[model samples]
Target: MFSRKTRLAVAIAAACSFNQALAAEQEQLELDAQTVVGSADESAVDSYRSTPSSAATKLDLTPRQTPQSISTLTRAQLDDFHLDSVNDALKMATGIQVQEVETDRTYYTARGFDITNFQYDGIGIPFVYGNVEGDIDTAVFERVEVIRGANGLMSGTGNPSATINFVRKRPTATPQARIDLTGGSWDKRRIDADVSGALTAAGNIRGRAVYAHENKNSYLDRYSREKNVFHGVLEFDLSDSTLFSIGHTLQKSDSNSPLWGALPLNFSDGSKTDYSRSTSTSADWAYWDVQENRTFAELAHDLGNGWQAKAVVTHVKKEGDGSLFYVYGTPDRDSGLGLFSYPSEYQDENRQLIGDLQLNGAFALGGRQHDAVLGASWSRSELEDISWYDTTTGTALPPLEDWSGNIGKPLNDAGSNGSDFTDRMQSFYGAARWSLTDRLSLITGARVVDVESSGGNYGSDKTTKYSGEVVPYAGVVFDLTEQYSVYASYTEVFDPQTETDASGSRLAPVEGVNYEAGIKGELFDDRVNLALAVFRTEQDNVAEMAGMVGGRSYYRAVEGLTSEGYELEISGELLPGLQAMAGYTFVDITDANDDHAVTYSPKHMFKAATTYRVPGLEQLKVGASLNWQDEVYNGIAEQDAYAVVNLMASYDIDPNWTVSANLNNLTDEKYLTSLYWTQAYYAAPRNASMSVSWKY
Candidate 1:
């Protein structure tokens, strides 16, 4: 067995040696390739172009013309960073944090709140079992957009954190194909392919298909995963000004690892340091598995009368089975004393159906200018939860190392615990944008939601349906110059509690309001986009107790909680052959009712990356990045801070082929990726990967 510090040192050394070797190899290859092709057309710059910034646009407007703070991760950025999932894509974004909640699950937070409000191609996808197991793949996306603050006018229900929207890749009228293969440490292997082209004469119809497969192992014992994703889309042009598109995606993940909880924060006598990294207290547990299927259809038509109507329908089904295990007790208070363990086996199933309709265009009001939008949406979700417990077990399970050789047998004909049940939600909303002047705009929106929950044999009793407030929003954008703009906005969001009140009725919804102000600029031929924003969000009238309960389930709210933050983002091709992206955030989250700083929000977080092509080496590119955060407290006891670096180099083998390598966590810092005192998840050890890609 290796000590934590020893392991960290070894990983760092390996990463450094690997990167050195790769750099040498890439340089040699670049020299050989340039000799053969004589550095063909170094000034061919057609590949870089600014598409619409999906993040800033509310109605398909360009980023410079929009009124808010939006950050976008382009496909080039994704490839440079070797991003394989949504978690990987947002890792270095401003104001965003990714925390590994379990071996196969991750949580994303923005501005001190969980950002579970996700949109696929501008449409909301219903999710359950938290945000960890949702069926989303980075392979099918062209870019990812993050809108900082509330977006009630677009998404009906959500938190005030941030909204993450995935923009799917669209088929071009011309034919194209790409294939990529990657291999790295831990026997990791990945394959991704994309094919798109016109499917009919006159280019009236176009279609695309994307596929990805990944298999990998982790440093932890008996921890591994395999995943597959497939996506398809079809687009048809009804007329010059009208278009229609439809798409669907399927994702499945299989893992051979159980949920591992956090570790202790301190040793005896209130010492700050405690626990060994390799100490696993439960090795007899089986792994958990999740399967998800989703399908959707959308239609957009421009009436040619300055009006457009869009409709969307989506369906999702998800299922899971396995055991979840965790350790519980006061560690320092009872040093060297083994605490109680929680182990449970269960199965879950969820299904959802949603529909949305919207109409947008321009209207004249008192000879002024007005761009208005009206929309309505409804969704229904059904959940079935089942579990079985072993009553003969002792209060404490054997240490993880001790059980390694004595794998426990599955309980035969396990006793059954009745099922738990819950239904979905229904909502309607409308919004409009009014341009008071050519340089000023005002936006307003509102929504109404109704929700209900029903109990089963082992779940809570039935709760009658309840309605929530007509949430409202207003915003103003003032253009100081052609290249500069200032904006301020305020929006409200509400989430209805599924539990019953004193009279056996659904409780009132928790209401949250977000206020934000920001400035935007476009410099250097619209190549650089810069934004700075300050925001404050407040949530009131929250339920007291809601979350995973007794291995069962529960719900509650933190009454009067506030999260405030400042953020800055810069993204673009800074120079002809140089491109850079960076983001920084400072947050102050507090429990307003108690006047205490929240436990998980880090005060300072920042990420920056730069990629440059060598002045005369047209065939080679090199990039590096740094991500850092200030100390964050764990359960009012322990605190930890971390900084990590990444490096990459790529060489064009020919017009049709390229080779690249990436070194992740270049310094191998030993730190907890997630913690709740007594429970901790370590960051990934340094790893290296080499990839070969071909395009035609």
Candidate 2:
């Protein structure tokens, strides 16, 4: 646990040292680059999407080529939209909704279910409810790909809603470099730099390095943060068909006086608007610090005979220390609001390891074309969490300076104790596709998974791992014309429940089925891509939150839950001088057991953006985007819908120099971005930023 004063001192020292090192490194790099000119393109999109020097598997396989629905967010889209974080990028995607829990915590949902499973370069990283941190930054990724429906084939035992994959940027055979600096309101400042080039004269080896730093103040009092990140990758071409890559990432973050829990919504009169934006209760002396390190290695081989093999291994370690403040109910809600308050301190450490292998190839059957894939994966994770609580007796007694020294003793009789948990999973799967004709295809897949968990304060017990249901998939794609196609697909997914009952028995896994039909087209000489899709999803044996009546979380099995939706999306270059990307979704989620609308699903969600270069000013480019979501209830209580507008402008001062500005929440709208059963969190206020970049 860190105190505010100590954390601030440490941050200052680190920043000073970092700046000195950066200056020295910049000078050295500049001198070396001046001696030789690089051939790589300096454009952000080109650099981000450059083909890997090492031969790798292509991601654009047809629905028939793969037994799943895959979606991608490209680097061009990220740059056009100015997406700075993973949360910012996902909100614009189809069939995905991101809910904000706190300033630093976010929850992801898809197909009317929460998505708790994630992967980096196809390596598993499991996440639990109570403890979530160490999120990866978008700066280090090349692209994001999502597999809709169940992904037991690769993720082992996990959520069926969706499986997210983040592809790390790898080094390129061509040399390139870029640097950007940004400053904005709330004393915000950020810098990002990327450099990549061939590591060997023969071009058999390449390497890439990226560094990013961000510091800013938040809307809440005494809330501020600083983050530092570094990413590096090396690639080697063992042969023309075989390649290997290794990468590592390190991140450190510090937050001043983070809040433990949100304030309750209602007062004595049961009115919802009883809280004040300026209300103060959190001790100014509290602080939080987090550190994360991750590394991975991957190898791929392409057998000229239409066969390919790939393997990946990854490991991650994270640790955190912090003090947080939580607000509780008072005896007299109307009169003694400040009398009831509790502060807690926590320390946590987590580590994970994962391995994956896959083989894919094409074969012929019954005079028709067929593609097949077989894969297996294993993962293990361990976590330790400890916490201490203090309860003060008076109603505003000591000053901020003395709060830490004159605190009460621990509240829990268990004293300063901790809990340790471990989770392990193994899975094997196979899938194949049959092309009935040049215009039609059939796809199917199945998987078996075994998962185990143990080691907690209540003692450890392992249940005989049960096999997951056999998932089946089918799809059809018809090429209507050179530029148009129609597709339909059905997929099934299952998610095992790790939570145990009072008798320590594992609950049945949840089952999900999805139906989808869509059309995809390319116009304007294959420059523009557009799609429209209608979809429906149903889940069986859904896990429902029962209640937390006595400080313990409880859940029950619900029979049926259903979600249906339609989406429209347009991407790629729209015109010679103009480019645009946009999407709209209409969702209707319901609790099939009661036929009531699901609490968190929005009815309408939309996003659109376009960028165009000024006719006379070739260096000037301007863009604007709109984001909106219809009203949805918070639990059973209704909340108002909200929308926000964002604007961006960039000017190329020269071929190697550029400047850009961005404005978010342009209207200064006040609305809740997300709400829990009894609480709401405000969206970010209107903010603006300007940045300068130089590339070589």
| Best model per lDDT | 1
Q: Which regions of candidate 2 are displaced past 4 Å?
A: 1-71, 157-160, 274-281, 330-339, 391-414, 457-464, 498-508, 545-554, 635-637
Clash pairs, candidate 2, are none
Q: What is the lDDT of residue 509 in candidate 2?
A: 74
TM-score of predicted structure 2: 0.85
TM-score of each model, paired residue for residue: 0.86, 0.85
lDDT tens digits, residue span 473-584, model 2: 5666777787777887776657776544443344567887777788877677766666777777778777654433212234567777777777777766666557776778
CA lDDT, candidate 2, residue 5 = 46
Model 1 regions more than 4 Å off? 1-58, 238-244, 267-285, 330-341, 366-369, 400-405, 412-414, 418-420, 456-458, 462-464, 497-508, 541-556, 676-678
On the 0 to 100 scale, the lDDT of residue 89 in model 1 is: 80
* Backbone clashes (count) for model 1: 16
The true-versus-predicted C-alpha distance at residue 45 of model 2, in Å, is 2.5
The residue-by-residue lDDT of candidate 1 on 262-286, one tens digit each, is: 5555555666544444444444456
Q: Give the clash count for each candidate.
A: 16, 0
